[model samples]
Target chain A: MTIKHGGNIYEVAKKYGISEGEIIDFSANINPLGIPNKLKATIISNIEALKNYPDPDYKDLVTAIAKYNNIDEDFVIPGNGATEIIFKIVEAIKPKKSLLLAPTFLEYERALKNVQSDVIYYLLNESNGFNIDKNDLLEKLEDDIDLVVLCNPNNPTGQIIEKDTLVEILIECKNKGISLMIDEAFIEFVDKEEEHSLIRCLADFDNLFIIRALTKFFAIPGLRIGYGLLSNKNIKKRIINKKEPWTINGFAAICGDVLFEDYEYIKKSKEFFRVERENMYSELKKLRGLKVFKPHANYIFFKVLEENIDLKDRLICRKILIRKCDNYVNLSNSFYRVAIKDKESNAELIKAIREVLYED
Target chain B: MTIKHGGNIYEVAKKYGISEGEIIDFSANINPLGIPNKLKATIISNIEALKNYPDPDYKDLVTAIAKYNNIDEDFVIPGNGATEIIFKIVEAIKPKKSLLLAPTFLEYERALKNVQSDVIYYLLNESNGFNIDKNDLLEKLEDDIDLVVLCNPNNPTGQIIEKDTLVEILIECKNKGISLMIDEAFIEFVDKEEEHSLIRCLADFDNLFIIRALTKFFAIPGLRIGYGLLSNKNIKKRIINKKEPWTINGFAAICGDVLFEDYEYIKKSKEFFRVERENMYSELKKLRGLKVFKPHANYIFFKVLEENIDLKDRLICRKILIRKCDNYVNLSNSFYRVAIKDKESNAELIKAIREVLYED
Candidate 1:
């Protein structure tokens, strides 16, 4: 089977000749609490919305997102997903030279390459828990660069840049006349999300752009809803001008207002992740021949110390799927990522990994 | 009220202080038959699919589209909408010079402008019932052009380019090394879809591309599913390489296979449009000061011969909405387009127009 960016249970299910429901998926970092009851009820009731075109401007959705983010409605640009926003920003910016982090979410590189933007990676040191070095990163934001992207509670490693350091980088980019795009797709899963998100910085920094998605936190990845925040009115105008109309379907369009207001689901999800992430992290740390990185989000990342283990393949035999991190730049076959799911599923994954590594 | 592309019942409802369902929508050209029962059942039954990420490759959806069109699976590139595919193709091609119809679907111009492609228009002759001249159009396909776009059974005018004429243009484009994109978004609404569609020619012509959507014939515009067909392997690969993953949501992904297989819905829809389109055309022509163009699709385009009639606004007072075509590049305020809804709605629209023009 071809290696793919994870959460591909369809492929795995076909390969194993089993139903998709049989596979315990830890490959995609989604809120394991699942879709909020309120949102689901709302969507089911409004199913007839599929008959008409979605509101091209997506006014109600944008208004709700802006209210939730505490930013001006004018600052918000909603998209099909955070991925769409990422590509649109690159297209709008058409940057000559952009800076990215190695082993980040793979979509950024794809988006940059689409616009023929020269990409330079700022390698995060594994010794520092795959964290960005503040001074070193600031030094690299020279006048020559047109764009700089940072993913908070970053993918694969589940590490984050310090708030002060991120602010400093944003200021440096502003000073150097470079556009700063901060992808906070996983920010909601992090504790104290307000402190880690640059959404507040949008009021002061015109060059700062932040992207957020309901797919991860709301557990509605299939719904495809995300928004970009920027105080730069010109960029916002350009995006609106250039964007295709009604990319968000009517069902997804109404989700922001309903999902953002589901405080019960939000509270329950945070609590679940808070407890499960810690339990899974500690359990995995107990295993031999594994070096688990402390995770800040819903997923844990680790490197295998033993040779020729083939953990992903072995786990698949037990009807478990975990992300193999080899495809990620600067990460090798020995590295892997797994989502912290429900307690029972997490325990099953732990048992499967133990059987593969220690027993045989 | 700001002039917008029609079918925006949200804005209209707000402006009139009325519920959306109260207004009869004629602005958007959707099937009068409404959403297929099979598709609705499939979507509702699989609502839990929203818990997982959509397959990034959208293999099932693409395969279904290919099988339905009798084309190669590799030739299909599914997107959020026909609109998204339009933007992606334009971005990928980066055409130096492109040709389009003056009063075509508005999104093509927006897509072309996004890539800074020089747009040249072939104005349909108003004197000839807004139809394209075959010989004249062929003469305009010069070697300097990089891309050519055709909207079959053209929007607003409801006219189709002859199949033979279209084939000649395709051969001409191939000889000139110009890429041809035929948008068949409304083709399923046409009486003879098999003859009108260019899907069969894709295997032979590398330069030929066609865009299709379930939004129209399937009556699921709010669902947002569309696919592009092209035999050009390089172009398809480039699009896949550049495209952001999971543009099609999971619910929309499963739709292609189910919806395309709904032959009962397909037969009912075609029969409905065939009868209603003709009935409405004859009814519209009976009006004293209206010139109704012969329609090939599910909508009728006509001109109000009298000046200062304000047909759209006057009908709006009667709680009916019709597309005022002044926003189209070469269309004027006197021109209007209306969907061929069910018999009752069609009668009400005809009655409203007669009342507005004759009584007032």
Candidate 2:
């Protein structure tokens, strides 16, 4: 009966009798730069907006998002979060059977279940650093699977599907009448995002759906805003027809104008991550009991060696929380994931892990 | 397909070239005392919380809600808003043929449609002031219908069902294997919410599902928080299993503690509304070309005289927006609904209407 996702800091804080702010949370992969200052100032000054309901149409927000992505306004459907769009897409598609990568974002499976849609998995071998081999994925798509969800810069592993591989899969899926939904929720953190993203191909592929989130890169998970971009008119209509008005809060609607256009924040974030991710990744790799996967995004996925430690509990004991990968369909308890935090925090995490793993 | 809900003051303000703060919005029936000061202060101080993800489990929020409602924590499932709960409940139940009150909150039908469920209506009669007729409803609750939704103090028309009628319906539904859902969203504004609410009956009726919202009562719609209450363990499990984690935002989760426990705000709001509603109802009743329905909640529903004016267009000219009930099933363009606002605003609304109907 426990909620099945990350970012339960309140519960974690209570269990350890610590302030929520005191915990270094890696359970959720949110941007470490925090809310953009401009966005913060806008929200603070416009706190009274909470008194009114959000625009039911969300025209301004949609237009802002469309302009940012250089897409048609009709292609966007903003939601409570990327998760809401995911759930709605599944409901709208009504696929009899869907295919997903093993150990991907846990929510796609939950969304599939909500529609009572059966799921088929294309397991990514742990030895391959959890990368989706395109040939294997295309073969798994076969014919009858109508929906395929790919978590690009995939959660937990932070391993993304390469451009050539993604293009092949998209072409194959289109030929077979299968819808390919790419969750690019963490894409902004990935270096050379333009190279891996299918966003540019959305206009050419009616069967492709792209999910984006402001909660992560914009560092406003508390505001609850995300959207789906797709070219399928029928599916778009079905989603809009099913959506609840004002699902995106008023404060969140203003966020696109503030965060997306905040060039300084974006540039600073990229620069910080360019240096910090490698630092954190190498530091974790240096640890004796863990195998850190090569990360493409802002988080590193690593496995605890069976011989050395209960990594999750060890980290929790130090008042730092990380996501245990056991709940993921294909992963075991030995695997864990942590966000590649800033320099000082990364050092603290490395220090904590060393203390926990190296001690007698 | 424009989303058919009101209180989009931000967008309305933008279109009308008015600041959102200047608009006297009577579209949403939120507490007329405006945002609770304590809740406002809490949000301003915890502005930094937007940097973090909301508690995925919403443990503290749930506990506060349980305490407020005097129910077991397990029986409640919080949502992004009451709308999300409605959407989730329909998906969880996967009802084959559902019966919804015509002229009720629009989301009920939309949610049912998302599941591709067949929806039938028990149309409320104009002669009855849109109140639920228990015998008529009981007759419509055939064994074939898996679900029935009632908006007590029903939207568009603020008529409430008495406790005895609701109890009889609940017991009958249980006997007939029908799931009865009561949306008590506006019940808090009623003189005796406890007496009229099926929340007490929740302990006894496994067949009953009660939907409640903190938005209208607490005046925090922008935060997007609401909860569903049901004693049926099976239904509760189904909902929990299907929910998107972190659906409620951090600011919203904190609201369960701040607003639910703020006795001073609650007392002052109720007092203000008790006087304002009576005054507004009397004023509207006296006005020509409008027939006012008796209101049990924080809004008034009335029909414009056919020969005199188009109320919606007239109100729009005055920069006032009221919900045109035409979009609601069983309601027509001649019908409109308005919120019971604060004393000064209520008087302003009355004067504007008088000028439109009499002087113009």
Candidate 3:
């Protein structure tokens, strides 16, 4: 079978001979609160804005992002999504040798390959709960490396590197003349995100780059809005020079202002996840044949201990979909990841898993 | 002065110290009929779709484009806009030497420059009304050139190369192992577009590539949907492999099936443009010091015969925006382009120009 990303309900529905709306998707880590009411109202009111072209410079959108992050306007560059910005950065840097985490997001590898950059992997050990070992990681950041990527509250595993440790790595990368990129796509879901984010360090470290997206936290993955931050003047200039204009659509461009200001939605989602993530993790840990990793974001990662268990397939049979992490490097078929949904859905998933595992 | 492209109403509004809604935009060549009513209704009804991630494969959108064009599904690839596809194709082909027309759509050059490809221009002569000379163009197709880009019913100048001449160029490109990319972005606005389009010849010419967009014809530039077509399996495979998933927002993805099926909107737009374009051209020709190039698209290109006339600024003073061709290569301050809008707006533009030129 081909490696697949989550949120692919079209293919999954066909495979299971079921309607898409019937399948409960725990594969993608989107906020359970869903699209904000204010955003929906904004879309309806400004529907006519679709007739005109989006601002080529996307000034309003960038201003909103800069204000939200409390960063300089020069540091913000909005894109079609985090994916486009990743490719643009790789193209601009044209790094000779780059280092990435073994079980990280797949697009980093694909973006680097597009620019013909030689990539080396620093494998995160499963024994350490998929967390990077500071000393081991430092050893891999040799003078020969030109770029290094970190995914904070990393996908699939949902583990975050401590702030001080990340700072040490950043200083080491700067000493070695290597650029460090931290993808904080899921950072907003982490408790005290401002403390964990490296965005503040950007002013002092010219070598640091940070990527953020509204897809996961804002619960609007369908809108496709993401931005990147960097204090390096030369690299930022190169990216802007190479970028295609108006990559963000009108509706997506308008989203940064309204969605980020949605305090009620933000507070409610964080509050829900704060309790639900723990409950979901504890329940899954009760099952005798599974080991659930402590989750820092809106998803949990786990390993099936029973040798012959096909947990993903079993859950899918009950109209539930969980991400099979076998495709990730350094991971085997027994590993899986699932999003922490709302109370009712999480309970339903837990019930289904218990029934499937205990029946045989 | 910084180089500017049309449809930058945001920047123009700021520069003129006026609101965006107050400015009459004749700079962008969008359909005067505005956003199709059906599209507006669909967007309102499907507002909740924004919570879900766009299909990574975009299978349904691609299928709709293929069906609309009467081509095989394998030949289609949807993008954020034509701009994204242009950059992707440049990256995939990695052309050593590319040939482009002078004073064409500027994004093509930017896309090629991003890949560090060597670009050679075939300057369109003003003596020939900015249209390519068949024999002269044929001679420039050197065997060493790897790629050739053409914009049919071209931007700014609004002149199209004859169908027979385009076919000849395609044959030569194929024979010399060069890729031919024809941008049919404005082809839908042309009468009998089927007779002039190279899309149907894809089965016979594997080296041919065509780019199209709904931004202009559907009056939805804010939505940002465009696509590319080619029968070359190898190139298509490379593009898909290198493409970042979900570049299209969910709303834009759903637009393919809805907008393409709006027959009433399509027929009315064609009928509207067929009359308005001629009226605008004839009215502009009545001025004493201007030479209008007969338009084949929704915009008309003209030259100010008299010196020291800042037509763009003068129109701006009247709260009307027209594109200045000074930034385009092989063109000067005397040249300008304006869109054929609704009858009232077109007449207002004509009145503004008359007062600025003859009355002054």
Candidates' C-alpha lDDT:
0.89, 0.85, 0.90
lDDT (C-alpha) at residue B331 in model 3: 92
DockQ of 3: 0.67
Which runs of model 2 end up more than 4 angstroms from their true locations? A1-4, A13-21, A306-308, B1-3, B9-23
Worst 10 residues of 1 chain B by lDDT: B1-10
lDDT ranking from best candidate downward: 3, 1, 2
Model 1 lDDT per residue over A263-309, tens place: 88888888888888898999999998799999999999999888698
Candidate closest to the true structure, highest lDDT: 3
What would the per-residue lDDT of candidate 1 be over residues B25-77, giving only the tens digit for each residue?
99998897889989889988899999898888888898999899887888889
Error of 1 at B189 (Å): 1.5
lDDT of 2 by residue, A161-223 (tens): 888999999999999999999999999888988998899999999999999998888888888
Top TM-score model: 3
Best by DockQ: 3
Q: Give all candidate RMSDs, comma-separated.
A: 1.7, 2.3, 1.3
Q: Following a full C-alpha superposition, what root-mean-square deviation does model 2 have from the true structure?
A: 2.3
Per-residue error (Å), model 1, residue B129: 1.1
Candidate 3 TM-score on chain B: 0.98
